[model samples]
Target: MSPTLLVMLIMMAVPVAMVFVYSTLSNVVMERDPEFVGIENYLTLFGDEIFRKALGQTAIFTVTSVTLHLLIGLGFAMMLNSGLLPRLAAALFRVIYILPWVFTASIVVILWQLLLNPNGVINYLLEAASLIDSKVEWFSNPSLALGTVIFINVWAGYPFIMISLLAGLQGIPGDLYEAAEIDGAGWRARFFNITIPQLFPILLAVAMLDFIWNLQQFPIIWLATGGGPLNATETIATFTYNLAFSKHEFAMASASGVVLFVVSAIVALFYVRHQKARD
Candidate 1:
């Protein structure tokens, strides 16, 4: 094989092969071996309340974070593209917005952890401003823990969406806006009728990608709250990690992973079909 072909086979083909082999082995090993129980691992996963809760939490986190990120990112992109700001000012804002995308997830998590500490700089500033009498336990409160993680995900992920939107915005022809203005269309009417229609494909693509990415986000939640405060923030990715590493249930972990993969694939397929129909 050619060198590039060899590399592709090694990098992509081998991992896919490994997954199939491992999944098949999981079934066979469980059945033939006395210690292994066939399909019991999979059954246990379905019957487990913790896993179900984790799935639900993951869904909520994915939907909320992706939706907010898309909305905020697109808004920022529109602001940047408005041409009201000076060239230098717009360039600076774009650079600042892009900073989060360049940083690694671990670094972002650590920085936010310190910022969120009870006695950290955030609380200190709030207290100095008399915002409250005491520091709030950002991660310790179950109600806030998952929401905080979702907020962090949005912060870290929005830059990519912003960049995508900016690209899409630039591609929109000035003639469309000019024609709308000639027709005496208001700004809101022009935006909704022209700009949004042109941007729909880009927005849909970004939303689908964000959904998949957020669904599998682990480091932010793991490092932030470790899915704590009574497992309120627990997600499928974190749950699978705990099952494999903490509980040492490799078979069950594989089963959970398969479930996640199937769900993600189904959602992706639906999104793709919808996008195709729209196109």
Candidate 2:
């Protein structure tokens, strides 16, 4: 093989080999050792209330964040493409929105921690404007913590969706809109009939990407709440981390990881089929 081919093979083969070896060893250890019982890790996962709750929380967070991100990002992209805004203004807005995606996850989470804190700048400003009576404990409130994290994730991640949708919007020929205008179709009708149908593939691709990313997100939740406020914000990723590192249950953690991978794969396959149909 050529050097480039050799490098690509090594890059792909190492992880695949490692996963296969690890899975085989894990099963063997579970079968032979009393410390690691056969399939007990999976049994624990299903029977454990905390794990089940964490899975539910993760699903909620992923769906809500992806939905909001797509809606807001596509909305902004449409506004930018509408020609109502000057070119310079639209470019500037796009640049500003893209900044969030460029920042490290740690930076975004830390910044949000400050912004969401009870006595932080956000509450201070709101108080000054008489928008609220007192500061709210955002991360400490179990009811609001997950939603707050989802909001932060959406805000920081929507730029990717925006850029994708904007590219799709630009590819759409302007004559379609002009023809629609001449035919007396309103903005909503034109958008629903022309823009959305044409952008379905891009939207599906972006949604799948966002769903996977949001589903596996760990650092943001860790930094903001550490899956705290009564484990209300625990995700599968964070749960796996705690199981492997804190609980010293590597087998169980691996099981959870496998489950996560399977779920994500299924979702991606569905999106692929849907995209194929659209094409």
TM-score of each: 0.88, 0.89
TM-score of 2: 0.89
Residues 1-279, candidate 1: write the lDDT tens digits.
599899988997676555444443444333555243556677778798988899899999999999998888999999999989999999999999889888888999888889988889998999999997899888898988988888888889999999999999999999999999999999999999988999998898888988888898999999888888799999999998997788766666777777788787877997889778877
Q: Give the per-residue lDDT digits (tens) of candidate 2, residues 111-156.
A: 9888888989998998999998988888899998998988888888
What lDDT does each candidate get? 0.85, 0.85
TM-score winner: 2
In terms of lDDT, model 1 sits at: 0.85
Clashing pairs in 2: none
Model 1: residues with Cα > 4 Å off, grouped in runs: 1-38, 128-131, 270-279
